[model samples]
Target: MKFADIGLSDELLRAIDESGYNEATPIQAGVIPSVLMMRDIIGIAQTGTGKTASFVLPMIDILAHGRARALMPRSLILAPTRELAAQVAENFEKYGKYHKLSMALLIGGVQMGDQVKALEKGVDVLIATPGRLMDLFERGKILLTGCNLLVIDEADRMLDMGFIPDIENICTKLPATRQTLLFSATMPAPIKRLADKFLSNPKTIEVARPASRNENIEQFLVKTSERGKRDTLRSLIEAEDIKTAIIFCNRKTTVRELAKSLQRYGYKAGEIQGDMDQSSRTAELDRFKAGTINILVASDVAARGLDVKGVSHVFNFDAPWHPDDYVHRIGRTGRAGAQGRAFTLVTPSDDEAIDNIQKLTGYKIPVHGGGAPAVDVAQPDRDEAEAEPRRGRSARGGRGKAAAKAEKAPARPAPVAEARPAKPREDRKPRNDRKPAPRHDDLDGPDDGWNGPMPGFLSVGFDT
Candidate 1:
């Protein structure tokens, strides 16, 4: 369905067209109408499904006529990360171009003065991260009472980051009669309870199954040793002839190191991780998006809600620790119905993590080489391969010379012993006839025979 068919205003439709989108994505088609109707919504769609616009498009029209009061935003959008909040703010700017909807972004890692000033000026839409928003609220820099529309974007991510309590606090501060919209790629029990507690009779719209893999994405597992991951990644990148790619690492340190490694290998690569300052991160991301860097190494911070178009491939340099992250990390590519490939560099230690990802996605990812079996089912073979050496070492007691000798030496037969005769008891001397043993004191006395200091052997012959 087109944006026009979703009952968006002409101004909003014009903005959508200018942004080069006519047909609404499944999430947008299912969600925009309910949002426009002022009903609460529960949008469950995987990443890269245009869920951002599902609410942003309708929200522009809803807040078009409202005038925001001082220190209070008309609508509140709570994103899990600074990048996601910034992305939502960008969406408002791109799609709300024709409308006079004021917007403000509240996130950490930047000066708060501008954000405070924006809040004082009253924004029609407020895009904020939970941490920064909560901090500002505590300082009386912002108010939530005027917010009639609340969007909890990436609820599952918020849960993962331990932001659910802050979200709950923000919800209570908002008007009790507010219309709340909760969106998540995968709804865990906690996210479900959050929606149950906050949203009022929300229309649950799921464009796809929770945590479902995008069909446009071709996912493969590249089995390699832990030390060989980088070489495998480089080989795959060259083999695939990747135009642009995002390499995900499980650690921020790994992200920085991998990016440097890629650059040293003559690839244009950039790094983004939680440790980097906001400005630096934005700069790196901008470089990646602008083609200054064709490969981006990132932590999970960029796994969700990062919309970089034309990402030709995704490489899991480290298989994600969380199963849900596997979905989002690969989702960086294959966005907007574009065909893309994702390769996970799986080491032996990542077996359980990869298994969890397969189970969560409900299908085993194929090995990079098509003829080989999938990684999930091939785990036993990997285990056996690893155990084979251990079993050999156990049987041989290691490869030492002694073990070799033990393996080669023949067993000796038991030797026969000669029988010995026992002495007759009557032939032995009587106990009374034996002389008393010399004492050490007697031997060391002044009258002792030729002794300045008794020899050590003589001392041993005497009893104490």
Candidate 2:
């Protein structure tokens, strides 16, 4: 049904119009009315189904009447990642523009002072990541008791990120009588348990079957070595008549390195990971959505709820470790009824991952043998690495030399006296003759908070 047919406020309808959406997405059409009627909701839909607006639009109307108090937000929306939280906050601003609703974004990697100020001014809608939200709550900077409407977006992701405990804690603080809305791309047991405990007689909406893929996407698997994955991705990007694509990687280090490699190869690419400053992440996403950036190399943070349009391809630089992620990664393309393509780079080691993904989707991704010559995987230059001074090494004569000397070298006695002056045996020591150096203690530093240079997923754009 058209958004206008739903009982949305004129202002919201106008915003939807400007967004160029007339008919609502399945999830939106199902959940919005129930949310508007003040019912708790458990929404099941895959990524790119316009689920953000399912809650954001109705929330604006419900919150339009209440004024937020300093440190006491009237409503709360919790997201699994900082990027998702920020995007939710953006939706509030976009839909609530005509209304005077105030909102705040609480996430990590930003100055807390600004968030505190926003909380103090009384926010009508507070969008937050679970970790940072708890930090503020403990500091007495945010009070959850007054929150009437609660939204836990990406509930399954919350479980993946180990935020369930934090969510349980937040739930204990909220008013028991408040309305709750929970949305997830898939309903794993953990997420379902969360819904059972929090939602009261909720209306369940499933827009698509769980873990199913969009039929419009042409999916394929490229069997290659891990080292060849990057080269394969570059070739696909170069050869395909691609408009835009999202390249997914599993590790942040790989993400950063891949993005840099792509850019070095003269492709317009950027990186986003958990460790980046909030402003930089925002700027990167802004550039991507505006079509200025051809590729965004990110992590799982970009897998869900990212609404950029016209993505023509998806490149899985690394196979997803989690089977569910395979669905979300491919879901980035073939959105809005448009035909799209997805290519996954798999190594011999990824056979299990490929099997799991196939089992989950119930359709085997076609395997292609020879695409292009895979790029040479980089190997640490042993000579260059060894050239660096041996740490803690002393020029001490050790037993190693004696042992070496005892092992007789072949006697190259007298070279035939005839020709050129007989060359003396070169005295350069064998590599093993050097005494082993003590290892540097600093090399053991903890990597606990490392957010790697690049996020795990990358997106690039192309106009159809």
RMSD of each: 9.4, 20.4
TM-score of model 1 relative to the true fold?
0.81
Which residue ranges in model 1 land beyond 4 Å of their true spot?
A: 371-464
Give Cα distance to truth, residue 56, candidate 1, Å.
0.3
- State which candidate has the highest lDDT: 1
Clashing pairs in 1: none
lDDT of 1 by residue, 1-464 (tens): 97788898999888888888899899999999999899999999999999998999889888889688899899999998889999998999998889988999989999999999998988999999999999999998988888999999989999999999999988889999999999999999999999889889999999899988789999998887764566677778878979999999989878877787788789999999999999999998899889999999999999999999999999998988899999988998999999999999887798999989989999889888873422333122222333446566654555544554666789778699897897988878988998455455543533346544333444456558
Q: Model 1 shows how many backbone clashes?
A: 0
Residue 373 in model 2: shift from native, Å? 9.1
